[model samples]
Target: LHNTSDYRVLLMDEDHDRMYVGTQDYIVSLDLHNINREPLIIHWPVSQQRRDDCVLSGKDQNGECANFICLIQPWNRTHLYVCGTGAYHPICSYVNRGRKAEDYIFHLEPGKVESGKGKCSYDPKLNSVSSLINRELYAGVYIDFMGTDAAIFRTMGPQTAMRTDQYNSRWLNDPEFIHAQLIPDSSERNDDKLYFFFREKASDSGSSAVYSRIGRICLNDDGGHCCLVNKWSTFLKARLICSVPGPDGIETHFDELHVKNPVIYAVFSSSGSVFKGSAVCVYSMTDIRTVFNGPFAHKEGPNYQWMPFTGKIPYPRPGTCPGGTFTPSMRSTKDYPDEVINFMRNHPTMYNSVYPVHKRPLVVRTNVNYEFTTITVDQVDAADGRYEVLFLGTDRGTVQKVIVLPKDEMEREELILEEVEVFKVSQQLYVGSTLGITQVTLHRCDVYGEACADCCLARDPYCAWDGKACSRYSASSKRRSRRQDVRHGNPIRQCRGYNSNANRKTMETEQYGVEGSSTFLECQPKSPQATIKWVLQREGSDRKKEIKSDERILRTDQGLLLRSLQLADGGIYQCTATENNFKHALVRVHLRVLNNETVNLVLTHSGLPMASLQGVGSPGTSRAPNPQYKDLLQLLSQPEMGVINQYCEGYWQRPANIEKQNLNKQQKDKPVREQRKPRNRRNHHTSWPQLPLLANHCQ
Candidate 1:
């Protein structure tokens, strides 16, 4: 059985965990829970030689009859409807759901071609059977004496038999089964319209890949008696892709499909292989939704924004394929998608965050995509319904922790303010980003800093954390975050702030105009003080608030003299205050430096133009070494958008009449590291859709 060819089928009595399986050479009953794959075999009374002697007109003579089902789905606590895929596929025995070995019911009477021989028994079963919600069984299999093409068969349990005043339909005098699927309606249920899916092909046998056509064989309310000459006609034939996305973002594939639950989450791969970076997509209630943070590669602009509606846009729209907006890099102008540019210029929604599945995943071309190495959501604590902490899996296989506070905790900008907080959190989303899985939990979501423990899961299910052991908390009872009475290990204690250069205990600001220019207004702290405190821990709408004259509002080397100051002092000012020996103090101050706004411009043609050193003549042509650049540099050069970055040591835009040395360098260049791309690659080719399945009777 291990080396050559020995197959078997096992039917587990859902109630008692008893199982029965039939293979090419044998049939058996098993204790599935105590699995050793090697099942206990039950020998048949007939021998191999005698099998050939019997022939049924319903099927081919020499072929094995055991090709269908040998296991049974219990119709009740006591009975099972069983059969095999063999020529003599019969309602052989009904076993007690509790103990199969002791309760053998009855086998059907077999029919044969030549009077002396019995029915052919090749495989234990000749068809596949699935159960309905209430213990009734539906099978699609071939009947030897009937035909090579299979039909449908329906059998019910004791309760259903008495309730419907019936147990099974018939084929002539014998009850019949239809080999069709019972399709669930998308809407409006009608007991009269039961549908089924099937598989058929042009070839007869020996197939490498079976291209099957799924069809719906529908039955009317009065279809009860059509069993004798049962024939399933085609309905809607289709093929499901092999792979899909798991809840955790990994690509998962399907090896088989069953009637009980029919949904798929898989990816379309590059080489028809799995795990080659095949991002999984989920299909539920019909429409396909790709999981994970990626959109269509071609659709992302130089900025790589995720636009969920790219596919909905006109094909080859100004920003799409053939559209001028498809720049390989955000800095490149090569065939820049003017359509998308124009669309973006005209519609504000173009910049809104509407993530498309495969097309432009970015809703805007400016916000940098969040680089996730590993992002997991777990109930690291159970005290409350808080899943704020996110475990990020980096490419180096290093684990980074990040905590994302709910809207109730901070403003929406606070969420975006995180550069490294994307690193730490308490809840765990157990999936590696590099692992290439697509897991999305849809629980709840909002923009406010409110607690999202109870209500947030609906928006993003993955964010739901059951913290039975990690933290002491509870989910919000309603759609709102539950306000917790101050308790131990609360959010306040969970969130901590840190900055490395502890020795630099000072506050600084920007000055106005040239040196020795007009002074400005701002405050700065000096000397050693461990921490700079913010006057208001939570900032809100109004600017001013009531304050008492007593508390040490500001402390500094100059001793907190918050009055007139120099122009260079217009920036972030800090004051030192220590709490429990921790040099931590609350800070509250604002600074403004005056400066004339200026604009900078960087002209980009295919290449640099050649002309006089000072533009004395027409510029000659040469490919610009660096045409792709960030817009910030151009803004810094142009005097229009705003004044130059005050912190930088360089001037704003260069004067047009400047000398060679001043005009010959990149205006703004910063040192930033490079990132890695997905190692696994997959492509799901979805046309606006014209598939071969349309060739069937679907028309």
Candidate 2:
């Protein structure tokens, strides 16, 4: 599938060496093997060589690509539908559009065949049609008569004679339908009947109800039949979801109903007041009274009984309404109500109109609650009574994927949230509110044929295909071999190290200057061409201070930026990236920017001043000074790099060669005493304990 050019969504068919992609404009199929390991990419509909073909077709001038596509074998042959961003029109093509029905081009591309024309074509009439099957594109149209509900249409087949069917009915004349699901049993070709499902709310307040409806038309139904009476019929009617409360509010938007496996999954976007974000619910296909309740299964009394919808839909319960305020509106009868007058007041959407329905159809029928900000689309796959996989693609181009784990009795899929990402499909994921396509093509390099074991083994880790094998070097063997690193450098890579000054104790702070004086925000290892932007948020204020000068700020290679000082530039300066979206380290710098000078630092008296005195008067000493503070004096001689407190935790580190006895004596004395006598005067050594040492030293 081909989508918007940025990131394409691709489906790889390993068996056929094929890849299908959905795009922002048109879908493209390519043979995975033909492009080597490298891919020959184009904008859209535009192949590498024929880049202007789509422009020549007179549709997309700038060649905007399709944003999404869902490829399936819905018919006798493979069909591909391309949906794009802002393109009201959606297009379709068969992989074999240019080939004979028998000639199979598994991955639809133009070059597989010796020579062929491009098969893709555009269709303008398809409405808010998200899903398509074969050439028949089913859509939910919105018009004046019908509020948003659902509808299915024959997008491409030759127009048949007019008939009294839902497509042409006046009473059911609704294009506002949001979804139209073609029932599997709707092959009515033999009986000349077509069946599909959609929910209808005549007016915003016309008792907003859920109608599991099916439309049918006899092949012989003559043309120009009576106005609205000849068209559609409601097979099943009941109330839809209510009381949905999510983050924003209660959501009542019923998105789409999917029938796959043995279950029916229906999802509503943001269905709960509290949990009301976006919710997907599952209904058992076995408990399907409307479908399996017919006489064919009467002997078994509905052999497949669907479990009541108990997951989460958010429909209102009967007791939810205020005591006497409860009122349900009249539904469609033999004669449909006048849409221009009665139905217009009951539009079902939040913005357009309001429809209120009061009923406790089922428990799974109420707001199980999900969360969504402004999501309008959701999809869930179900099997049996369980939901298998969930795919919720938001209009913001976010695709939230959750997997369902399998259990013994529980066949439904469970939500595995750990696996989630806002990924970029080969192109954009959404055209507007749909999924874009991407392609993953597979290639095989004849490893055994090339048969170069030497070349393959040397390129350990990245194996060169050896005949029937890959020779990869083991880490243990490589370590033992200890060969010189002759590897080339990678253009893009990141390195990390601990933020420490010297002995692992370091504190970082910024320096400030006066109001008129210039300040320099400094970072280590400055680069000549590196640029920097300094953002300052005021100390107490929430607002950010703007930069007026471009000349002073500097960028450095050591992850620091220098800024020429100004009064307003004093708060917190955080360096931001200009070329990329990177918010570098944040630092709070207090730029005084004042008129008067302030004392910088009195390293001598600021905290605890260290004074080291050498024996200047005499070189010889007969007695030892004392035993206390012997090592402490030595430590005080080193330069101070940070705040110092003698009693601070883990502050003392004695000389590595000092004996434990000497260390204990220095620590326990009332005050530390140090031996200041000359090293050679041991013959007349005198020792004074702790406190008296200081007093005797003065004599």
Candidate 3:
């Protein structure tokens, strides 16, 4: 159930009801339904000789002399191809599930070792990504011991391993790999292509800067002969820009991207400074495809400068996958002449870069110091439309749940739904010391409410709008007729008939605090585009008064904060939000204030005599009440209540209560000449007796 080592690589086998996990020097298989049960763990440590050699090479024994499992890919239904950093020397092996003995829980398939230098990393901290495509391993990694030879390679094939030119900055210049996936060719005429997303140093920008890129390589490519032997023949990369046009007319770009599907979300900081904050930008797959099909960049002679190639192209094109009459044997780069192979070798990068859809990010978070490490997307169905929920994991052991509202107007903005601290700590956690998020997975759609509208509106492929309730969908369900029209259908109309009540929900709450203390009231709108308004409703008055910010009442983030509470502040406060479409959401709070005299009178209702309560905490008495009761007595004796921090704005502490003895002494020491007669003392005492025991009682 628990592993001390970082567990990042995981594969779920729904057919076997098991989950496979890769960690430091070990691979574990656990039951998906009951992970508490003992898991089958395999110890795959590096050889003792290798560990010894790592330490001899001036590396720490505790850090570098251990195998950290990096990549785990399912080769087939019965086998897994796994690779690891083998004590600073990379190596890999295949794991078989069919070899388990009858009595043993696990037995690995015996296999020969293969060099994993380009499949994993020498340093565990470095980034490397690999995926199985067309029965071959497509990987982005550092190919040398010094990690200076970064390349995208297609390894483990019949002919020979092919990679980007070694030490070639034009191909990949100081890159940090994020992830890779094989997108099935929509045309179906061409072979599938593997796309890798990464952040690398940009050269053509005329300045030292990092840019996020999406690189693609054909699966049918074979090493070129004579011209660029043992190198990729159809590898190309393009820049991905996800930036916003700032108010100052400057474009802010997010340079680190995480790709999933139709959209690729990127995290960007204003600068290299850690405290500059970060933003999440989104780019569409359509935009990426468009950029790839645009102009191609070529290296000219002089300084070998990169410029758009305008010459006539060869048949089947330079980077096209082998297709139609062109079989692998006929169209492979090895079969091409030296002239064709040399041209492609010098032009691995595309001339045009991909820009984000609408040139803006779906979500932008500001004033956050922690950089995002990983991200996952979820969807929720609402009356308006499907909301794409983004869960971004940060370096500070926290996960931020955000949502991109479907454009209700001319503009759309990202909403910060919640910020969750995944790890608990009593003190501040330091950078690099915090546990990095290895993965984020959304389990299932069972969490959606049991309404057809709820499931259908979510627009999650895993869920469908079953007539009665929101539930998981099956491929050949006889109830397909019961499902509402989704594809090419309006979501709001499908759910509007049955779920109108939730769309019109209004929130009402009551807030109670002591007079002369602070109080906070909040109203949170689901959409960030909605403008907030606050109004006060006084007793016996129907006239509405708009609340204004002053020294006594200040507006804080998403709410209102009232400092130094007074009797006049007690009223029915209402908060209303108006969206661009004129749809309104409202929340009302009835706040009541209680003075010290009224609080003391309420305590007497608990059956304690007024005189006994007053003397309960007298000094130097053996029969004195408990110290806890003394604190309570002091609290009740205070002139006013402390301020309440509503809507989680910030913290507020109350001033200590004045001692009763000091108050009595000051009253006795007052000069008779200067003393004034107590005005309506009897009337004030009589009013306290009639005060309500609870603030809500008056409401």
Q: By TM-score, who's the top model here? A: 3
Ranking by TM-score: 3, 2, 1
Candidate 3, poorest ten consecutive residues by summed lDDT: 678-687
Which regions in candidate 2 have their CA more than 4 angstroms from the true location?
Answer: 1-19, 30-127, 130-151, 155-262, 271-275, 286-417, 424-699
TM-scores across all candidates? 0.31, 0.35, 0.70
Q: Pick the candidate with the highest lDDT.
A: 3
lDDT of 3 at 198: 87
RMSD, each candidate, Å?
27.0, 23.5, 11.7
Superposed by TM-score, candidate 3 places the C-alpha of residue 431 at a distance from the truth, in angstroms, of 20
Candidate 2 matches the true fold with a TM-score of: 0.35
Better of 1 and 2 by lDDT: 2
Candidate 2 residue lDDT tens string, 1-699: 322443333444444444555444444445554422333232334343332443444545444322223322233334343433322132334444223333443444453321110111232222343334444443333311122323333333343323123433223434323333433333332222233334433332344433322332222222221333322222222222323334886444543332222244444442123333344544443333333222110011264332333322222211111111211232122222234122211211111111121211011223323332121222222111222334444445444444433433434323322112343531122222234332221111222122232122121222232223323322334222122110211111110121121112212354544322233454421112224555577768888765444454544444333332345555765543221121233234444333222211222222322232221111122223323223222333234423223322222454434435554565676353334421111111443433322112211
TM-score for model 3? 0.70
Residue-level lDDT tens digits of model 3 in 277-396: 566667777877777777788767787677788987665566667652344446565777666677677767788888766677666766756777667676644333455777777777
Local distance difference test values of all predictions, in order: 0.30, 0.31, 0.64
Q: What is the lDDT of residue 71 in candidate 2?
A: 28
Among all windows of 10 consecutive residues in model 2, the one with the lowest summed lDDT is 486-495
